[model samples]
Target: MAKELEAGFTGSPVEKPEGMRKVASDTASAIKREANAVAIGVSDHPQAAGSLVLGIGAAAFGLGYLLGRSSVSTRTRYWR
Candidate 1:
């Protein structure tokens, strides 16, 4: 145990492989390209973008309200 402790661990630091780095770079480029495309689309059609956002918001709100009501009813049923 003492000898093992004295030698200690000596290893090279772990690093991301070249393949992973290339993959990450490619993914970032793709995301940037897509975002730029979306920006251009939204800029070209502001009214459509606004309506899309509002529709998403309304859908999210409705989902949340339904989930909340279902949970309340479930708890009351179990309590009785």
Candidate 2:
């Protein structure tokens, strides 16, 4: 194993396939388009955007609260 490691391995340079490159480019463009659309929608309806953000925040807080409560209860039960 030491001799093999000392010999050192040589490898050819890897090149990205044309089809893969095209697919990656397409995916990037699609993401950009979607982001632009969302920005436009948010700009058009500021109130809706604010509500959406608040709703997401509330949901995240509720999830965290539930998880924390469950973990605390589990710990107490184990200690008992």
Candidate 3:
């Protein structure tokens, strides 16, 4: 495992397949634009974002509370 790891770092860099560069670039740009749009939306509507986060938090807390109070199996002695 150690040898394999060392070889991976020291070995020649791998090359991407033909046309992969263009596809990768397009996908990355699309993701970047979407992320920027989301950021702008969040910034313009801070109240909306806050409400969304609060609602999600409340739901998670309620779920956790119920799970914690659930009656699961108890430990037992098996050895004889």
Candidate 4:
């Protein structure tokens, strides 16, 4: 195993290092554009409105749950 490993390490050719930085920069640019697009999409419509509604609803539910636990006859109090 040691002989085979030594032979493999001694025999391989080295690679060229050109354009690696350029590739990295290009990949970063693409990721930034995708993130901006997603941000714009999320900001743009009925889905955002729906998300707001859901947030409000969850908050209201939490508040109601907390208040309900502190009182007696929750259904009776809300009826009037």
Top model number, lDDT: 1
lDDT (C-alpha) at residue 4 in model 4: 44
Worst-scoring 10-residue span by lDDT in model 3: 1-10
- Mind giving the per-residue lDDT tens digits that candidate 3 earns over 7-66? 346654487535977699789999999999999999999999999999999999999988
- What lDDT would each prediction earn against the true structure? 0.88, 0.86, 0.85, 0.79
Query: What is the TM-score (0 to 1) of candidate 1?
Result: 0.69
By the TM-score metric, which is better: model 1 or model 2?
A: 1
Best of the two (2, 4) by TM-score = 2
Please, what is the TM-score per model? 0.69, 0.68, 0.52, 0.36
Best by TM-score: 1
- What are the runs in model 2 whose C-alpha is more than 4 Å off? 1-17, 74-80
lDDT of 4 by residue, 1-80 (tens): 45544444664347643598668878999999999987787678768868988999999999999888888564644455
lDDT of 2 by residue, 1-80 (tens): 34546455587448654798779978999999999999999999999999999999999999999999887744434454
Each prediction's number of clashing residue pairs: 0, 0, 0, 0
Q: Could you give candidate 1's per-residue lDDT for residues 1-80 as a string of tens digits?
A: 44546475588548654797879978999999999999999999999999999999999999999999887844435455
Error of 4 at 32 (Å): 0.3
Residue pairs in candidate 1 whose N, alpha carbon or C atoms collide under 3 angstroms: none
Error of 1 at 31 (Å): 0.4
